[model samples]
Target: MKYEADSPEAYIDLLPEDRQEPIRRLRKCILSNLPEGFEETMSYGMIGYVVPHSKYPAGYHCNPELPLPFLNIASQKNFIAFYHSGIYADPELKAWFVEAYRERVPTKLDMGKSCIRFKKPEHIPYELLGALCRKISVSDWIQLYEEKISR
Candidate 1:
């Protein structure tokens, strides 16, 4: 779904009733596990956790004026997506996430380089996702992102 919300709360309010609860639960899990210095905002039509410009003036590599993206949660036509920038830039974290997810979730793991796609938010493994979120701080992500993009 194409969303145009000015804030994360607005984004959530835009979702259908069936989607709201699941996304809320997922958002709770994500926020509870998030490390310090990450602020929630609306980005790319989704609920985004980012390193604000105040903390990282360079912002995102593709758009320097925007805040650096950390993670994004969105409801799509066919599925819900959780985009983890940390796992995308760090191979070790990706491997660990995959292995841990495989051990916990009996269903197939549908994912891209950074986005974990699920037909419904309830299908996601909250514990593992939370653990992954806890693994990366804003500073850690800035360093990792800088290293990856600098290459």
Candidate 2:
């Protein structure tokens, strides 16, 4: 997906009408469980929740101007995707996410290192998604990001 909006709200608005409801529901799930200090914004051509520059002045190690990305939700070419940085870093969390997803949804989980792709809104594992979102805080993510770059 191409970068379009400068803000989260704008990003939501730009989504196709059919994609809007699912994305909005997922967005609500994300926002409601998000920890303090994470800021929602448009990043990497998606709706992103990130550790703000104010919270970590060094910003993302890969690009200093960009804030550290924590999670993102995007309507892709064929699927709605959820990107979770914490799950990529923590093997334990990844395993747990996979297990929880299987327990919650009958469909096989479609996932990568950090991205979970769902074909439709009905396929979303909302509870597991919210739990994943709540698993890491802004400070925790900064620490994890720091550790990752150092290694």
Candidate 3:
């Protein structure tokens, strides 16, 4: 579900009452562990963590007007989606996350290239997500994005 929100607070406000808290918790988890250089904003209609243009003037390769996105979280139609670009770009990181998730969460992981979907909000693994957020710094993401993702 795409919400037209101007800010992260607004995005949370727009979600269903039950979804708000989980999204807020997920947002907090990411914010608390995210590296210093990434900024929080609304991107692709979700709450996004990105390397601001102030840090990388060239901005996102696909669209120079927007900041380079590192992560995003959204309340989707049937689940909560956590999108981490790092896991999609780095094979080692993806493998680590897959293994760690199996060890930490009892349910089967529902994941895509960059999106990790949690069908039950109560089952969302906040600690593992926090650790994932800490795994890559803004500079490290920039380097990886340039090497593996950018055209």
- Tell me the whole-model lDDT of each prediction, alpha carbons only: 0.89, 0.87, 0.96
Per-model TM-score on C-alpha atoms? 0.95, 0.94, 0.98
> TM-score winner among the candidates?
3
Error of 2 at 108 (Å): 0.3
What's model 1's TM-score?
Answer: 0.95
For model 3, how does the per-residue alpha-carbon lDDT over 39-143 read when each residue is reduced to its tens digit?
999999999999999988989988999999999999999999999999999999999999999999999999999999999998999999999999999889989
- Please list the residue runs of candidate 3 whose C-alpha ends up more than 4 Å from where it truly belongs after superposition: none
Model 1 lDDT tens row, 1-151? 8799998778889999888888888899988999989999888889999999999997887888899898999999989899998888899999998899999998899999899999966678888889999999888988998899535
Q: How far in Å is the alpha carbon of 34 misplaced in model 1? A: 0.5
Error of 2 at 11 (Å): 1.9
Q: Provide the lDDT at 140 for model 1.
A: 90
The C-alpha RMSD in Å for every predicted model, in order, reads: 1.1, 1.3, 0.6
Better of 1 and 3 by TM-score: 3
Superposed model 2: Cα runs more than 4 Å off:
none
